[model samples]
Target: MNILVTGATGFVGRRVCARLQKSQSYNLSSAVRQSGSNPPGSEVVIHEVDGQTSWQCALKNQQVVIHTAARAHIMNDEVADPLAEYRRVNVDGTLNLARQAAEAGVRRLIYISSVKVNGEQTPAGCPFTAEDAAAPADPYGVSKLESEMQLRQLAKDTGMEVVIIRPSLVYGPGAKGNFATMVRLVAKGLPLPLGSIRNRRSLLALDNLVDLIVTCISHPNAANQTFLAADGEDLSTTELLRGVANAMGIPSRLIPVPAGLLQFGATLLGQKALARRLLGSLQVDIEHTRKCLNWTPPLTVEQGLRHCFEIRQD
Candidate 1:
């Protein structure tokens, strides 16, 4: 199999490349952003991905393209017209690459989207599913949703298979953003006020997500399907903190702060979204993914956390 993986230098991309390389089965080609950010096997160094970017050179002889490159979602962006900035890369760039890949006879293109496409929070036990109507709440989510629509249409128009995988808060080795911050705080034995947060949030282990992506590559049932990927186990903020403490073999240092008080403070600070994220439910139902791809997360939450923290020490 001739597989081309975009975002080769990214957290998930690097792991995907490494996992694929270890197998020594597929002819893996990694598309990196810069010159020196190589990932083992064959490399295609594309400086930037945008509307005007050309991918014909890279798409040649590539059978399956795992499109993982995109402008990551962030709370604060220092760019003017954040929406345009998002569209430039996420929307325009992805479509351009897809179009070229289709023309270049790429058989499949798997898009790594976000669970944000299904909306921010789900009602208590009602997890988000692929059947749910897309309700993107942010510029990044909107851009992703737009890209998904385009990809699906391109799949219909051209005979290229497009697999969409939306993963929840991904965590593991080399993880970043909120999850990384939480691990660091727990490791430092700092008092975290998330004990009172009874919210259940879904998380996707990096290995689990990579496993799903790899499974989707050749799975006939995965063609033209949008799958929500997660570890199948949901955890509350308090439970998560305690789990991290247990995983680290340290005492759980958490304060019982009221959710209402936290929300109030966040409101005053104009961070209501951040507050909801900390004290709300955002779960994803991976039943469809399991049924469709015959896949299950290969690692438990504890195992994934251990791999992460252990790697952090090195």
Candidate 2:
């Protein structure tokens, strides 16, 4: 099979490319922006992703396209209109690639979406499922939802297959953002104030996500389906920190601060959003994905964190 993967240089895309390359069963090509470097052992096609970007060259002779590129979530975006900017790159750019892939006789397109499409957070003990109506909470999530809608329509109009996977809080080696920050804090044995946070959040390991992407590429029942993926485990903020500390062979020094006081302090400091992420529940139900695809995460949360610590040590 011939496959083209966009954002091949990104954290997730790099792993996807490496796994596919090692399998040695398919011909791989990478579709990257003009500024990105090509991964070894794959063909590279360069194009800007915007309202006017052309994907004809990149989509040629490709059987599957796994799209992972986008304007990722920014804590404080300085753009005049963040939503419009996100739409231009994420929504418009993705649809353009899908249309060109269809025209080039591509078989399937796999989109990497965010669990934020369901909502910012779920009620305690109530997980978000794939069947729930989309309730994107931010500009980034809204853009992904719009792109998914458009892709389904495009798949129907053309005879192309589309598979959507929404993953929550992906973490592992080479991870960025909050995960990276936590890893650093744990490595240094810094004190944390999240010991009282009882909220549970679902997370996806990089290996698990890559495994699911590979499965969706060829699974017969994956076409026209949307799935939520996780490690089949949920952890509270304090528990997650302890896990990280254990992985790093360090003692956890967590102070039990009340969740409400923490939130209030964060609000005063303009970090309420970050506080919610730490103290709120955002769980996902992957029962449908497991039953439909007959799949399970290859690695457990502890094992994944161990691997992450090993990589950090190296």
Candidate 3:
């Protein structure tokens, strides 16, 4: 099988490439941003395709196009209109790539979208499902939702298979995000004030997310499917922190700070956004993904955490 992967240099893209190489079944073509080298194996091909220009040339005879490229979340983006920046990359760029993939006769296009497309955050007792109406609260989430719409629309005319996978906070080896910062803090023996909070959130282990991607790549039932991916385990902040502490070979050092006080302090420190993210729930329901793919995560949360810590040490 020939696979063209955009964002092949990204964290998830690298892991996806590694997994595909290990399988020894698919030919991997990396759509890179620059004229650079591909992964070590000769099975990998690197081509520059920034979603503009003649990007479709790289997708020749590709069986599947896994798109992981997007303008990810950034803390320091000071554009007068953040939506424009997000649309340029997340929406316009997506449609551009999809059009090119369609023109190139790619069989499938798997879009790695964020769970935020369901909403900026899920509420307590209500994990967002694939059936839920999109109500993205942030510019990034809104852009992703728009892109998904565009993909659906494009599929109607192109006769292409479009699969959308919305993953929650992903963590594991080489994971860098809010979760990574939490792990690093725990590793450093810093006491976290998250223990007091009892917000349940969904997390997708890197391995499990990769498994879902592979499943959707060729699954007959996955065509034009919108799925949510996770580890099938919903964990609270306290449980997550304890797992991190255990993985780091240290005693749990989490303090149960009062939620109100934490919010007050966050507001005073000009970090209300951080406070909301930490204290709020962002769970996703992956029942549809599991039922459709007939898949289950092989790694437990503890196992995933161990892998994360081990990778951080190396």
Candidate 4:
């Protein structure tokens, strides 16, 4: 199979390329920006991603395209028009790539979306499923949802297969953002006030997500389907922190603080949104993916955490 993966140097994209290169069945290529370098042993094509950007050179002879590039969610966006900026990349850029891929005779296009397309949080004991109506709460989520819709329409018009995988918080070796911050705090034995946060959030390991992406590449049943990817295990804030601490071979020093107080404090500090992510529930149901794809996460949560810790040590 001739596969072309965008965002080939990104956290998830790098891992995807590594996995695909190891498989003897694939002849891998990377579609990167002019500024980005190609992964070793893979063909590279440079093209800008924008309204006027062209992907003809990259899409040639490519059977599958795994799009992992995007204008990621910004925590404190200083831009005057955040939505427009996101749309320029997430929606417009994505659709442009899909249209060209379809015209180039590509067989499948796997889009890596986010669970935020469902909503910010799930009510207690309820997990977001693939069938749930999209209720994206942020601009990034909205753009992703719009791109998914556009891709489906294009698929219908071109007879090209489209497979969408919406994954929850993805973490593993070299993870940054909130997960990395938590790892640092835990390694330092800092006292965290999230002991009272009893919310359950689903997390996807990088390996698990990559595994599912690889599965979607040629799976006959995956065409025109949207699948939610997760580790099939949910953890509370307290449990997650403690698990990280355990993996680091340190004691977790968590101080019990009421979730309400935490929210209030975060609001005063202009971090209410961050507080919601830390204390809220965001669970996903991957039963459809498991049953439909006959797939299972190869790594347990503990094993994933251990991999992360070992990477940190190196």
* TM-score of candidate 2 on Cα atoms, chains taken together: 0.97
Q: Give the clash count for model 4.
A: 0
Question: For candidate 2, lDDT tens digit of each residue in 1-314?
Answer: 98898888889988899899987678888777654485744657566787687777777788999999888988789999999999999999899888888999999999999998999999989999999999998999999999999999999999899999999999998899999888888778878888889999999999999999999999999999999999999999999999988888889999999999999999999997898899999999999999999999999999999988797778
- Count of steric clashes across candidates, in order: 0, 0, 0, 0
RMSD of 2: 1.3
User: How does model 1 fare in lDDT?
Assistant: 0.91
Task: Give me the overall lDDT of model 2.
Answer: 0.91
Lowest-scoring 10 consecutive residues by lDDT in candidate 1? 32-41
Reference-based TM-score, model 3: 0.93
Model 3 ranges with Cα > 4 A deviation: 40-51
lDDT of each: 0.91, 0.91, 0.83, 0.90
- Displacement of residue 231 (Cα, Å) in model 2 is 0.5
- In model 1, the clashing pairs are none
TM-score of every candidate relative to the true structure: 0.97, 0.97, 0.93, 0.96
Check candidate 3 and list the clashing pairs: none
Which stretches of candidate 2 lie above 4 Å from their native place? none
